[model samples]
Each structure stands twice: as C-alpha cells, then as structure tokens.
Target: MCGVGGIFFKSAEHGAKTGEIAYRILDGIYRRGPDSTGVALWHDNADGLLYVGVNCEAPGGGGRILEALDQLGTVKQATDGDGYIRAAIAYGGSEEDLVDAIDALDPAITVSSVGRHLEVLKHMGGVANLDAKFDLKSYDGRLAMGLTRYATESRIDFTNGQPLSARAVPGLAVMHNGHITNYHHLRSSYALKGYNFSTQNDSEVIPIMLIDEMSKGATFEDALNITVDKLDGCFTYIAVTDDCFAVVKDAYAAKPTVVAENDEFVALSSDPQSLREGVLSDIEVWEPGAGEVHVWQM
Candidate 1:
C-alpha cells in the first residue's frame, strides 16, 4: 500500500499561506508511505504566467543531465538528497521549450508537470531526507500536491517513486495507490506511440497515458474516465494541475480515499490520520464514492 494526498487552493484568496497549507497537508500523510515523499505547487506571478516544477529522482545516471541544463540556461537552484535531486531553472522561455531542453539535456531527465501555477517532483526516500535535501520549507507557490510511496513493483529506490508527471501535458502530475495488473500491456501501447518508459513501476504508465489522452484534446474529467475504463486493477489516484485537482478510485474500489474540505481549502488522502496530523485538527472527513472522480478547480 502507498499513501497519496493533495490540496487545491484558490491562490488569489489564500495569498502567502498557500505553501504552508500545502506542506501541512502533505506532512499529514507522511506515515502512509514513509519510503519517499514529494510535493508539487502551482502559482502565478504578476505577469500571469504559471510556474511549475516537482521534486523527484534523477535517473540511474547522475548530475550530467542537470549540468547540461545549467549550460543551456541558468540553474537557479539545485540540491542533492538521499537517492534524489531537486533543482529549479530560471529560463525565460516556454514550458514546452524548457521541457524539450531538459529532455535533450538527458533522455533520463523528464519534466514531471508544468502549468500556469504548478510544479511537481518526487523520488524514493523519507520525508526528512527530501526536506533536508531540498530545503522544501522555503519554497513559495500557490497550490501543491505530494506523495509518499512504498513501492510494490519497481525497486524501492529513487527510480520508483510517486508524483509521476506528464510533461507532454502541461500542468499534470499523478500519485497512485494500488496496482495496475495490465500495466505491461499499457506500457507497450504507449511505447509504440513514442512515449518512453523509465521505472518498471506501473505508476509511471499513468502520466504517459494521461498525456496521450490530453494530446487528443480530452479534458481532465474525460481523461479520468478513460483511464478508469482502460486500466485493469484496484487503484486510487490523484492528479493535480495549475487550475484543477482530481481524485479517482477504481471501479472495484479496493483502495481507500478520504476527502475533507471547507470554504477555506480542500484536502484528500488515503486515510484520516494524515488529515488529522498534517492538516486541520478538527474537520469533517468522508470517504469518496466507488468509481468516483472528484474534481476541484481554482
């Protein structure tokens, strides 16, 4: 089992406290999957452009990928953690251009998500490791989502981590719980479409499929429905973007998902303990319906 959780906030309304709120929400679920933890936050500047990035793994190969990116543009900030690395690039270019540059820099370097207000990153390790390594507390953003993973398929190292992102689809990142039995078949299908696979974990297949559907002009809701229909297994998945956030449970509903929200904010997690510890001390919490797809927009 894995622990997944996220929060969607009206950045304009919450203003500066958004990052703190997001962090607390993520911190709540640290016990669910202590193997690794990561977060994605979204926010807009006065210019109205979105800023997004994630904290995740740096393929089997090391700093060569990051060094190449630094050569192309300026590497704003970079930090090394146990089995992971977190970095930021200050590029005055399009997200697509930056993503292309990152990919070109190293085939292993992938953009987890991009949006007017979101960025995400994740990799194998404890929350403390990610925090000390990345200095996450100082990060500033609007809305954010994070995950702590205990791998079921791939190795329990940096390669198999959560907050898997869909770079091809701007502003999309996913965290999943449970297994996708038909993952091999799905992986082959996407491979034929030119989407490469990295980690052997089934969760990696999610972003590729989501990006493919989005490329075909599917809305987040549409993509969610299609994903539930296509993937064969028991799962509870969460996806976040600059403008929206969604949670979908498989048809069989074998996995658990609880949602808590009020006028100020909305939070979701695999269990209530995290919500209680990380978010609000006293809040109403309810389990989502079976085959349910919950969406929140900022």
Candidate 2:
C-alpha cells in the first residue's frame, strides 16, 4: 500500500501553513509507505517564469545543470540540495521543449517538474529524512500534494517517486495510491501517439492521460470523470493545477481515502487519521463515493 495526502489553502496568504500541514499529513501515514516520499507545491507566479526541479547524481552535476540552464534562457535563481537542484528560469519558449532540452543533458539528470507555479521535491526514504534534507516544512505555496510510496512495481529510486508531472502539460502534477492493472496497455497507446513516459511506474500514466484528455478539449473535471471509465484499476488519485485541486477514484475505490474541509482549506489523505493529525478543529470529514470527483479552486 501507498499513502497520499493533499491540502489546498483557500487563501493565498497561507503559504507557510501549507508546508507545515503537509509535513504533519505525511508524518501521520509514513508507516503505510516508508519507501520514498515526494511533495509537489503550486503557488502564484504572475510573471510566467518556470520553476524547474531536477535530480542529478553525477559528479559535477550541479555545474553541468546550471550550464545547461544558461544555454536555454535566463536563469533567475538556482539552489542546490542533496542530489537535487531547483532553478527558476525566464524562458519564453514552450514548457515541453524546455523539459526536453534539459533531459538531454545527461542520463543521470532528469527534469522532475517544470511549471510556472509548481515545485516538486522528492527523496528515496521516509518523510522525516526527506524533511531533514530539504527542510520541507519551510516550503511555501498555495496548494500541495505529497506521497509516501511502497514501491510495489517500480524500482525504489528518487526518480520513480510520486507527485509526477506531465511533460507536455505545464502546471499539472499527480499523486496516487493503488495499482493500475492496465498500465501497460495504456502506456502502449500513449506511446503510439508520441507521448513520452519517464518512468515505468504506473502512477506516471495518470498525469499523462489527463494531459491527453485536456489537449482534446476536456475540462479537468471532465477528464477525471472520463478516467474513471477508461482506467481499469482500483486506484484513487489527486491532481493539481495552478488554481485547482482535484481528487478522483476508480469505479471500485479499493484504496482508502478521506477528506476534511472547512472554509479555510480542504485536506485529503489515504486514511482519516492523517486528516486528524494534520488539520485543526472545525472541519467536516467524509469519504468520497466510488468513482467520485471533487474539485476545489484556490
């Protein structure tokens, strides 16, 4: 089993609180999935600058990454961490092309996420260890989603972690629990259409599928509803964009999920205990029905 948690702040000013609560939620469910931890956050970026998070393990990787970024556009800021680097770039080109250019630098370097308002950080360990390395509680954003993975099918590594983003679609990321039984079929179909997948994990398909549907004129909510019918799996997932946070489940709803909401914020977790541990009082809690789709906007 895996654990997933998402919190959305109704007010944009609660950036600090966003990081604190995300830590609590992950801490509550770390036992369910101690293999790896990942978090993705979305905030306000009015200037349309892309925040790119990448993982590089090669020697002198940080310098190489920065040099690559310089070739692409103006590097506004770059910060290095353990096995990871986040760069803010002012590029007036396509997000997809930017990601592709960075990905070609070295096989050891892959763009974890790239969006105007998104930042993703992940590690191959528990939540506390991840926090110790990156000080995750200090991360500030408007909405956030995190995952503790059990590594059922994919290799246990930093790149295979959850909170995976779509290469073709900016400002979209997904975290999920439970397995996709027909993942190979779906992967083949998308590959035939020239969609590239970075990892072999099943969770990666959710964001790509959503991007495909949205490219075909489907709304985010409508794309999720269509996914319930198209994906033959017993999974539940949370997808987020710059201004929206959404939760969806398959027809079976085999994986556990609970949600708590109030006027200030909405929180979801793989189990109710996480909400209790993460959220304060005065929130209404309930379980979403099978195949339900709920969305909240920031």
Output the number of the lDDT-best candidate: 2
Error of 2 at 139 (Å): 2.8
Angstrom error of the Cα, residue 255, model 2: value is: 0.7
Candidate 1 per-residue lDDT over residues 27-52, each given as its tens digit: 66666777877776665644544343
**Candidate 2 lDDT by residue in tens digits, 45-151:** 77777888887766568788888887889898887766777788888888778778878888978888888787787877788877876778876666778989999
For candidate 1, give the lDDT of residue 35. 81
lDDT accuracy of residue 237 in candidate 1: 91
